[model samples]
Target: MTLEYLDYTIVFLSLGSSIAIGVYYGFFNKSKTSEDYMFGNRQMKVLPIAISLVASQINPLTIIGFPSEIFVFGITFGFHFIGMIFVVLILIYLIIPIFYENNITNCYDYIEKRFDRRTMIFLKTLFFILGYLYIPVYSYISSQALSFVTTGINVHLINTIVCSICVMYTMLGGLKAVVWTDVLQNFVMFFALLFITYIGVTEVGSFKETFSRASDIGIFEVNTNLDITSKNTIWNCFLSGVLLFTCLIGFNQSCVQRIVSLPTIKDSRKAIILFFIGFIITVSIVCILAVVMAAFFNDCDPLKSGEINQSDNILSYFVQKLSINTRGIQGMYMACVVCASLSTISANINSLSCTLYKDCIKPFIPNSKNNNLIPKIIALLSGVFLICSGFVVEILNSTAIQIITTSLNLVFSTYASTFMLGFLAPRIHSRAMFLSNIVGFIVILGVIVKGQFFSGRVQYEPIEKTFSTDC
Candidate 1:
């Protein structure tokens, strides 16, 4: 189960290449203007940017979390893909044009143009805070994956190492480096999943056998319950997916920056379409891998057998067991996890830097010659913050996926709503928007409090357990 020297070499080379790419862009091909550094001179090709968009969106959370979700729940989670298609269509037709037409570096720039500086500042502050909180979860997930591969190393040290590498590259390369590395990482991620799925299915005899075993245990059950509180119902999946994508792809700064980095609106739209294709394929593969893992362990469930400490670790456990004598497979899997984490962390750092310098720091130091240095410094500071926050995550000892999902919901629940108000309801006065935002914020807070403290009225009953002995 331990990683061999060759396995370690494979992972090191993978990560090392990412840093090298960052160094190449950050130093040798230095971006002269803020535009070049922040938006890649607006000359990036659609294909790489498309791949980057997909890569940045698929992080450790999706890589690890999605499989864990499918394992614990069922195939009903796949219905979210339907909702994703709906959201991406909206983005291509309605959202990207506005941002591209405005030629904005930060997504919040449209807020200032549409409403007033006060409203823009409020949303910018929220983005900055939420982004800061979110980056740590990425680090925590990367460190967790690193722990599986390098069991001798401490998780805290792993976090520091992973975050340091991400910061170094992001500080050096800027947006171009992030995009190019994402192209590479996305391939690694796909290959890893393909390899794991192939091995898992082969071990289970065939794809037919795999599904037959899964179906025997009712893994194909779709949640048709109408109850709003039901976690994975079709309605819940569709609505939550719509909201999640509206916030993430429609309004999130990290996503918007990548979309706008392309040369033209047409290219950005194309990138969105390409991204959707890649997203669906990759997500479907991961979900199938989840079912495959379930089939592989149908007889000896890892959670029931206490072979793994957490559901999130089930994939890692499966990888280790499958890679007992298989040399580079484990390293490849670890590389996949690292690539997923690094792409996301780097994108967030770059986007957050862009947000801070453009919205917060530049106003004070207007027309300064050293304005370019602001983003670099902020990128470095962001790395340190992520590392520190990662330690806090470790201290909390929470599941990375749950913490991330909850945090995103709390931080971004009203973001898409506010953006829609600005974009679609232009005649709405800034005062009215401001007041509405305040009231909406209060209502969201009340709902959160109610869910946390006054949830006695609704209770979740566990699904009946039925394990299959036909592995």
Candidate 2:
């Protein structure tokens, strides 16, 4: 859908408001110490942080990717809720208290306290590198979304503008700005989805009809297959979902920073609970939207009709089709995608800055004051680096380069296992934990190489094209 002036105005208003928030906090209630900048002085309330958690966690990829999965695969992916519940329980009972009790700024700090400085240093290096690399991917994804709505604007230019705005707020206002801006963006995202879903349902006639159309195509099947390698099986969903969240929410610095930013462990736990509720609700809405889209496109499936090149384009295609008469909906959807990306990128920038300071810089500068300037500088530079890297990603869009990058990313997954070892098996030797990390990296590398070289390419069944005379 082409965005007109009104749509652009709405999107800019949303983006400008976020920067305005950062300016207000950065100038008026400026953070006094590194602690205040990094942790919000540990005085933040539960509700806003809960909202921020959802905002940060639901990246642009999830906004588009989840809906695509539902549209193409089936509702079987919804079974992840089962795994999410188990992960939340584990985080509340076993993981969060350890970080909260110690009052640590960065999650990696816990590794130092539990094991040794060497182990912390090792993991910190890995995290910093991975964090830096991943931010560019987020920027690229966000730019792609913006490009979809505004075909006149260059994607790289869009990337630079969005990254600059995020850096301005994050560098100026720090964590508090990031959290509050996230709160605002979360509402925009929710409203966008809700409005789109309403329009999609009304256009499809009724909810029952939507589901009936989807069910007719076997989209309601829940795969209960026992095979471990079978994707989307109930067992696979529950087990892999638990492990993924344990890694993502439990060990990741971005998530841990938000949890520990609350005043007390009690409040932190409450924020987590509220986060889960909001998360489940938002996800359910997205899944329902997917079903609605399936019904809306039952006959004119975009992929089959060649209206879009990829499944990920389905949401954008649907928005554009709907926007033929509905004017600002396209802009709102673009804002939603941009909001999701900005929230996640800003959070990572803040968390990575804090982690770099605490784990890498501070140890050597023992007598340094608790100044906020250094972290802000680090965040600014990090943001610039991410923007530059987006250009690199855009230029080097090749399968081989992607394979290498994807393999490197898999190595970071070892953090979850290492974190589990440190938290649950404190009795295990630090040396063993470090060695196991190395071994895990090698094994993952081997697997990636084998898959790239030996495994056959995946082939997907094409959706059958059916024309409707009504259109």
User: Each candidate's lDDT (Cα)?
Assistant: 0.83, 0.81
Clashing pairs in 2: none
Candidate 2 residue lDDT tens string, 1-471 = 456898888889999999999999999998888888888888999999999998987788668877887787777777866688988888999888888778776787788888777788888777787788777887787788678767779988999999999999999998899999999999999999888888888888898998888776666777787976564677776776677667678788888888888888899889989999988888888999888888888877777667788777788888887888677888889899889889989999999988777656877886655777778889989988988888787766343224334634474468777787777775898888888887887888787777556445644343332334333
Judged by whole-model lDDT over C-alpha atoms, candidate 2 comes out at 0.81
Give the residue spans of candidate 1 off by over 4 A.
Answer: 369-371, 454-465, 469-471
Model 1: worst 10 consecutive residues (lDDT sum): 462-471
Q: TM-scores, in order shown?
A: 0.95, 0.93
lDDT tens digits by residue: candidate 1, 412-454: 7768777888778868988888778878878887877676564
- Residue runs of model 2 more than 4 Å from their true location after superposition: 395-412, 454-456, 460-471
